[model samples]
Target: MDVTVVGAGPVGLVLAAELALSGAAVQVLERRADPDEAMKAQSINVPTAEALDRRGLLPAAEQVQRELLERVGSFAGAADDRPPGAGRPAPERRFTGHFAGMVLSPDLVDWSDPDLAAHAAVDGARMVPQPQLEALLADHIARLGVPVRRGVEVTALEDTGDGVRVDTTAGTVRTGWLVGCDGGHSTVRRLAGIDFPGTDPELTGYQAVVDIADPEKLAGGWTWSTRGAYRYGPQPGRVATLEFDGPPAGLPHARLRSRGGTPMAPVTLEEVQTSLRRISGADVTLTALRAAPTRWTDNTRQAAAYRSGRVLLAGDAAHVHPPFGGQGLNLGVGDAMNLGWKLGAVVAGWAPEGLLDTYDAERRPLGAWVLDWTRAQIGVLRGDAKSAALREVVADLLSTRDGTTYAVKKISGVTQRIDLPGDHPLVGRFVPDVWLRDGSRLVDHGHDGGFLLLDRTPDGAFARLAAAWAGRVSSVSDDHATPTGVLVRPDGVVAWASDTTDIAAITGLEAALHRWTGAQTSSPAHEPVS
Candidate 1:
């Protein structure tokens, strides 16, 4: 096998598919015979959409047939009072001070680059069912001809000198690398002996998805009645979800059981319907029920090393946490995307092994940042006096353009700026969507498999840099002149950049390249800027 991916969930399937698309022979081992039945993650953010789009999977994701509601309104206390639809005059807002945050529907946001902006607009989140998403990705992987070995478990893994030997229930297999896209409890992570250090939330959450006749009544986006403690969302068609803070005893009688169920009275569809009626004052009829236990763990842990020789961890295998900010699935997909290109390059022999180390360095901090912010948001949702006070400030800030921008950036993941600092604008920041001097959009580089150098000047040093890397790097010159040149990683991040075409002015280009490619290559000789 070119790559062995453990687990066939959305993350695993997506990773295998991405690697397959990049021409790597991949195999995915999953214990389940098919996809999971329950709907887990229901949202995708801008960065995630952009990542999927790069692999031409955005259209498939959209084809899952989910629609977004235009607005999200929050409530404080349960009220039986019913207001008219959006067309009618507004009723007195009962939870004026209790409202936490509003998530705008995705339709209102621009998604010109369907992949780039998949979750770009509509309050930094898009509502999509996890089952539907997984099914769609599974279909894509099948279409790509990647083998998904369902009902097979990876029993053991041994790192061979040159590659990895994977022992699955299906039999023994050999691969240049192995990726752990398995969920929070990943066998691959364990096999690699990676330590996952993080804190589990003291609180537990219960969610039930049911088929309701009047889901549309609850369909104006999700409403948080008890801050983060309790929430509800209406899915397209007749599906609706009710989630609440778990009791001290835990769900279906404590002891922290699996979604499969425990000894206590099983959570039934009638219970879900009854809970909905009690909370929302709507007598909803339930057709089906899916119950699960959830926790808000802020464990900001990543693998001590993303890769140990031939085995690598991606997605939940790398990090695990609560889904407070809808970052769980998105973060996993990001890990897949970040590792996909590098793995592709190495397999194709375009780059050396050292490039893989940057995956941990670059992504670990991002995981930590996400964990911190999500924890803060969860704290806000705890609904204590401090949280209430903070919500008021946040709500007020959300009303202004700047506040909206900040909130949107935070939620949508557009604000992720890498900590690579230098004088260049692209340094320590995400490469912005800029027009090249040649009138081509930076987003249209059309090379997703290798490093791209964007220089405005037709100079020798720039050419020399590309020449030194040869097939590993591709050079693109902007006909219109600018002083600086930018080098973008395969994942669309700026790795090395400069403000002047003198090439010599770009002091750290070589060092940056070596750091990015993980190759012990010599840096381009350049004079230090005084």
Candidate 2:
């Protein structure tokens, strides 16, 4: 096999699909016998939504989001009976999500900001639940003829220079590459001897749906206390709480979910009710517990490195942080999208020496950023006097136009830019969703999972230049397109761009194709685009 992907979660499935799209032989192995239907992520960031659109899964995601918005169930901050997106202003003017527990105001965001507006497209973010997204990807994988072997756990890995030997519960398999998309307690990462070190937990959090004898006794939405934070319903029987006292003395880690996994220990009526009373000081009583209660902590950590020879890590295996702002699922999805095509290039034998290493270089810093993002929220939610004061400051900042726009930009991931070598302003940034002259959009060509060149020159000079890297890139052109050329990577990042398709600009395009696609060319110099 070309690649053996561990863990059948969204990240693994996405990576597998992208590999298949890139013509790489890939298979997935998951430990769980069945899919986990627990309450996990409730939304996909803008880039994640665009990623789905790239794979033609956007329609299904939209359908699922409509269904999820119909009923606000266990998920906190879920939309009410109004509908998924009914009567909202322009997508840019809306409040992103929350910062800590404080909700951002829609009117406070500066919709006029060019940086934020540059990334918005016809499709904003979507509210598709994690389980729905997995089902969607599962169907996509079936169409692609990729096998996702569930109930098979990774026990060990042996790197034999050219390939990896993966020992699983069912049997052993050898592949040119092995990727761990497994959750936080990743066995592949553990067996690879990769260092996962970071800050410890400061509080224990709980989420569950139960029959409360007196539902009105507890406050609605997110309520905070000096002890910690708790959320008690926009929906009946839904309750979540966190305590600064940390997990119970010795309760086997009291974990119920790992970014995307099944429950570990059922939150009993006694355990949940006591936790509620301790934090809420309410005389609330629980009669029955519905679904398994989930416990998570701010136990943050990241892998020392993303790659160890032929063995690699992505998603939760690469990093773990508090599920604040629903960043975990989006972060993992971004990992799959970023690593999929790059790794495919490696397995296809056309990859440059340091191509695969770019995955580690580009994604690790984003993982670090997400960890601190969650840490910032925890700092505001610490529930101490210090926390209260900090909350006031952040809340004040969130009320301003620039502050709200910045938060929205960060949360939506619309303006995410990687540090790459290029002089063009758009280089290293996620390509803006520009409209093509043929009445199609740049995203229309993204579904093929190949490099894209959007060139607009009467003589089609740039398209001819990109033709040198045939099979690896496809070009789109028409007279109606603007007088600019853009080279987009498979992950939707702008690799190169030029304002004029002159002789000098053609030389630059040829060099970019060589640098990014590893295709040898005779182009000697690259002139920076003005």
Candidate 3:
């Protein structure tokens, strides 16, 4: 096989699809026998939604079939139901989620910036649950003709110079590359001897849905108490509680010390009620526990390197943090999008020497940023007088136009800039969703998993480069106001663009093609340029 992706989660599936799109043979190994139905992650942020859209993997609005959270959810402030602008008739602005349990109101956010707004074609964040999202992604993978082998756990890996030997529960397989998307307790990462270093757990968190005996006592939504915080569902049978009382008490006996000396434990209904009572100080009782209660800690950790020889890591294998902003799934999806095409290039024997390394260089820092972001949130969620006061101050700031804009930009992943070397303002920034003269969106071409050259006036040189690159690079003739030409990578980041299609422009385009896709040494299989 060309590539073996461990863990058939969203990230693994996405990477497998992108690799297949780039003509790489892919096989996914997942330990789970069946798909998970729990609502692990409930939303796809704007940037992640765009990433799915670019790949044509985003399900239709009607197909999502879930509640549309037009406004972002936050724990920072109380929920607002006034439609952001108090029933005003203007650009609809919704809350942009929250930071530190405070809601960042949409009324305070400025969506007036044309450049930023250009990246906002989708309605808003979609509230698709984990199972539904997985089903949508599984459909996409099925269409790609890739097989995701379930119930196969990766046991060991041996890097044999040209390829990696992966030993799984079912059998052994050899591939040119192996990616560990198996999550935080990644076996591939462990076998590769990669160091996962970060902060230890400070608090234990619990999430579950249950039949509450006394639902009237506990109010819907968030409640901050001296012990901790708890949020009840809008209706009965949903509850989440958090307590700062160290690792959860009464862990099932099957845990204490697992492999690698890390602690492991199973959460029970009794413990859930205990935590809830301690945090909320309410005599809330559970009639029946519906789903398994998930117990996690604020134990943050990240792999020191994303790659180890022929083995690599993405998703939870790469980093783990508190699921404060629902950034975990989105971060993994982004990593897949970023690594897919680049790794595909290398496998096809045309990638630049350092192309694979860029995955770590570009994504590791973002991982660090998210870690710090969650850490900061935990600082405010300390459930102390000082933390409460600080959270109030943040909530006040988030009630302003400037504060809302800044928080929205950061939380939405729209302004998460990549550090690429270029002179154009668009370089290393989110590609604007510009409208082509043909009435098609710029993101439309990105589905093919190839570089895009939006050249207004294409000549023989541009045509020749496109021909030489063939399926690797695609060129489109369009008249756009921002620039005469734009070169976008497969992941939708603009690499090179020029104001005119002169000889210098052509030279720049050629250099950029080489820089991003590596040198096209094959003889030109010329395709006519429009």
Candidate 4:
């Protein structure tokens, strides 16, 4: 196999699909016996939605997700106490994410800015369950003929000079590269000998579905106490409680063991009762426990290095943080996107030196930023008087126009800029999903997983030069835009753009192509004259 991807979750499936689409032989190994029905994160941020749309999977995702949205009423993160239709038609309904306990609302952002909307690309959020996302990706990879094998646990890995030898429960397999997308406790990450370093848990969080004897006594929103914070509903029968008292002593783990669970135990109704009693001094009784309660912590850590020889890491295997703002899946998806095409290029023998290294260079900083973003929130949500004051101030700031826009940009990842070599402001930015005169979109041209050239010059020289790269690059005639042409990479980043598609512009485009995709053999008919 060209690539052996461990963990058939969204990240691994995405990488596999990209590699397979690019003509690489890929296989995915998963430890899970089957798909999980438990709904984990339901919030999909704008950037992740846009990434899916770029790959032509968003339509399918939306087809399933739209029904969920309509059924659930899609009012997550909106003001609960709105004065009955106060705002102007709700401005396309961007979902609310939070920095800490403070909610980051769509209403806070100015969606009218053309540049912001252009950067948004797909222009919405998705609220799909974890299983749905995994299923969607699984179906996509299946369509692409990428095989995903389940009930296979990778126990060990050895990176030979030329390839990686993976030893699983089933058997040993040799592959050119390996990627670990397994969850926070990643077996592949441990086997590859990567050091995971970061802060420890500050608090313990509990969540469960229960039958409350007195549901009316419990507030239906987030509440802060001396011990910690908790949120009761938006979901009836579901309760989430947090405690900053300390790490679990033994009760939580013991309950999990009694129920035949693992060390990172599932919370019990008794545990929830104890936590709530201690934190809120509430004597609310439970009629029945419908589901097993689960325990988590704000335990944060990230791998010291994403790559070690031919073995790499993505998703929770690379970084793990508190589930603040629904960033884990989104961050992982971004990692897969950044690494997939680069890996495909390397395997296809067109990648320049140091191309793969950019994965760590680009993604590591973003991971660190996310870690700090969550940490900042954790600090203010500390359930203290000082922290409460700080939260109030920060919440007020987040409600301001500039503050809201800044938060939106950071959370949505729309303003994310890379530092590629170019004087054009959009050089390191994602290329807009520019609509052409032909009734097609710029994103449509990227479906083949190739670089796109939007040529609108009087002479067709730029288009001819683009043809020199053939399968590595594609061109579309856009007799519309201001710049003579725009060069977009397979990942939808603007590699080069010019005011005019002259001889000079063609020379620059070729150089840019060489910089991004390496040198291609030129034919006499397409080669530019110096």
Candidate 5:
């Protein structure tokens, strides 16, 4: 096998599908008999969608649902004028207005840009159930003719210098590479001796998907407090969640569904029902419920190395943090997408082993930032005096267009620009969608799994470099002079740029390629004439 993926969950499945699509012979091993129950993580962020769009998987994921705007249930703003007859008897208000909570906007790169639109459409995040996502990814992998071994567990792994020898419950298999997409408590991480140092689960939240006759009437965000215990939920539909500080004795482990393993007692549906009734005046019937332990961690820990010889780690196996901004699944899928092309390239013998090292360098810092921001959010939810003050200040600042725009950028992940310093606008920024005069778009540059140069003019340097690299690089030059020429990496970051006709003024294209791709080619002595 070209690659062996552990744990056939959504992350593993997506990674397998991506690798298989890249034309790699992939095999997936799972401990579970089949897909498990849908528990958490239903919302996909804008960056996640953009990442999927680059791989052409967004459409299939979007088949389930479209973008979901954040809703505010009961928090009100300070309007100058009060409601009519405020002095008299007033109607009871359960919650306030819609503009209270945070809003994550769409990606910065517009879909209308012809070059980018054709390559990838900028669809906002989709809200699909986790189980559905897993099933779809698994089906996509099967369609690609990749072998998926269910009900099999990887017992041991031994690096054979050339490849990895995997021992599983079903049978023994050999592969050039291994990726662990397994969730927290990951067996792969343990086998690899990776340490997951992070904060303990101080807060526990209860989530339930219940059938409500008047779901529409109960829609919006909610934050209710009872005896200092906070339960916030009813995020715009029938799904209601209750989050509270864990009891001093700790929560009793109760299995709400078969998906989450069995645990100790003290937790039950009756207790959840009582809590819901106390929180909300309505007597809501319970359909399904599960408890999720939220932990605060660095979110930056990797295997010290992504590849220990031939074994690698991706998704939850690589990093774990609170699911605060709906980033866990997205982060995992991103890990898959980033590794898929490189794994394919290495397997095909185009890229050297050193290319894999970039994964940790680029992604670890980004992961740490995400963790820091999410921890700040958790602090706000915990009602820390400083965090509360900060929220108030932020809310006041958000009254302005610029402030709101900044807030949106921060939460949406569009602001996450990779630091690749150069003259080109596209470098360090996501490749913006370009509207070609011919009316075609070029969003899926990663389809071929190589570096792409979008030259606005007839720059011979880019063409020459592409010709020299052959199958290892791709270059496209449009007749029209777009604002700037963009160089996109296999993972979709703009690696190089040439804003003007002076393509030779900057470092040679060969040097840029070698730097970005970790290629060992000699740098061209003379810059080609534009």
Candidate 6:
């Protein structure tokens, strides 16, 4: 096979689909026999929504969002407004997520900011939990004819120069490339000897669905207390708490088994009850456990290198951080989006030299930034008086137009820039959904998952120039876009852009094309591996 993706979660599945879309023979191996029903991320960020939209999968995901809204109603209104069992009836305003434990108000955000304005094309967050998102992606890959094998664990990995040998519980797979999308305790990462280095944990967190004996006593939404922090219903029976005692099981992140599920062994009801009582200081009791509880920590870590020889890592295997801002899921999704097409290009034999290396160079910095972002929240969230004062100052700042805009920009990732070579401001940023003269938006043409050359010039010289890389890129004329012409990679990043088609600009476009698309080949330089 061209690529063997470990961990059949959202990241692996997305990478597999992109690989298959780029004409690579790919397969997925997951350790779980079935999808975990635990409530994971409640929403997806800007780039993730656009990634789904470009793949023609956003409608399906929006349907999932709609179904979710129909079930729970819109997540609107303030936490204190609802008494226990107060029936959260809302078509009210949306919440913009939280910093530390402080809830962000959508109204406070600066919608007029260019970053948020452009991101409005994709609009606000989509409320779909982790399991539903995974299901949606799994179905997409299924339609793409990618095989996903569950109950298969990666036991070992050997990168023998030419390819990778992956040993799994189910069997062995030999492929040109291997990606570890497995969770925090990734076997593939371990076997590959990739060093996962980062800060240690300072807090232990818990999320569970349970029957509370005194539900009315607990507060709604996220709450920071003198003890620690706790979040109660927007959903009945949903409970989460953080205690700054130490890491759950008092172990490092590497020693932990997975994202959740009571950590290594099953946590008892007594443990949760004790935690809730301590954190809330209200004597609230969890009467019955409805589902398996999961333990998390502020244990942040990232793989020292994304690629080591023929083996690569993505998603949780590549990095781990506190689940602040719901960034963990979106960060993993971004990794898949950024890495997928590049890896696929290499496997399809049209990628220029050092193209694969760019994955680590680009994503590792972003991963580090995310870790710090989460850590910043941790800094505001300790039970000490100083942290409380810090949280107040941060919250006050977040209430401002500029502060909220900056936060929104970081959270949405709409106008995020990579360090690509170019002087054009649009270069290294995600191309906006520009309209084409053909009456279709940019996303309409991206369904094929190839690079796009948007030439708005009257004579379409750039389009003609782009035709040389026909098999790898599609040239379209757009009358509405700002840039005279723009080259977008399969992942939607702008590789080249020009406002004036001067000789120098045109020459630069050609260089960008050659660097990204590899030699103007009429067809894939190599056939798909079986």
For residues 208-248, could you state the per-residue lDDT of candidate 5 as single tens digits? 44444444334345554442222334332234343444432
The model with the greater lDDT, 1 or 5, is 1
Model 1 lDDT at residue 404: 51
Sort all candidates by lDDT, best to worst: 2, 6, 3, 4, 1, 5
Q: Candidate 3, after superposition: displacement of residue 470 in Å?
A: 1.8
Clash numbers, per candidate = 5, 0, 8, 1, 18, 0
Model 1 residue 434 CA deviation in Å:
3.4
Please estimate how well model 3 matches the true structure, expressed as its whole-model Cα lDDT. Answer: 0.75
Between candidates 4 and 5, the one scoring higher on lDDT is 4
lDDT (10s digit) by residue, model 6, range 1-530? 99998888788888999999999999988777887665466778878888888898866876665555544543333233333233322324233566786766677777767766665545523566777889899899999999988877777778999999888777878888888888788878888899989889888887787898888898788887777899986666778889987786646554244542223665678888888889888978778988767777888999999988888889888998988767888889889998999998888877753788999998888899899999999988988888889988998999886887677678777767899999998899888767666667777788879998888877777877777788788888767447888899888889999988667767788889888888766543333212
Q: Of the candidates numbered 1 and 6, which has the greater lDDT value?
A: 6
- Looking at model 4, residue 306 earns an lDDT score of 94
TM-score of each: 0.75, 0.91, 0.89, 0.89, 0.78, 0.91
Q: Between candidates 4 and 6, which one is better according to TM-score? A: 6
Better model by TM-score: candidate 1 vs candidate 2: 2
Tens-place lDDT per residue, model 2, 311-338, is 8999989998888767988889889989
* Cand. 1 Cα-lDDT: 0.60
All models: lDDT?
0.60, 0.79, 0.75, 0.75, 0.58, 0.79
lDDT of 4 by residue, 323-392 (tens): 7667877888888888888899888888853788999998898898888887887888887788889998
In Å, residue 273's CA in model 5 sits off its true spot by: 2.9
**Full-model lDDT, candidate 4:** 0.75
In model 3, residue pairs whose N, Cα or C atoms come closer than 3 Å (at least 3 residues apart or on different chains), thus clashing, are 72-95, 72-97, 75-101, 75-102, 76-101, 76-102, 77-102, 77-103
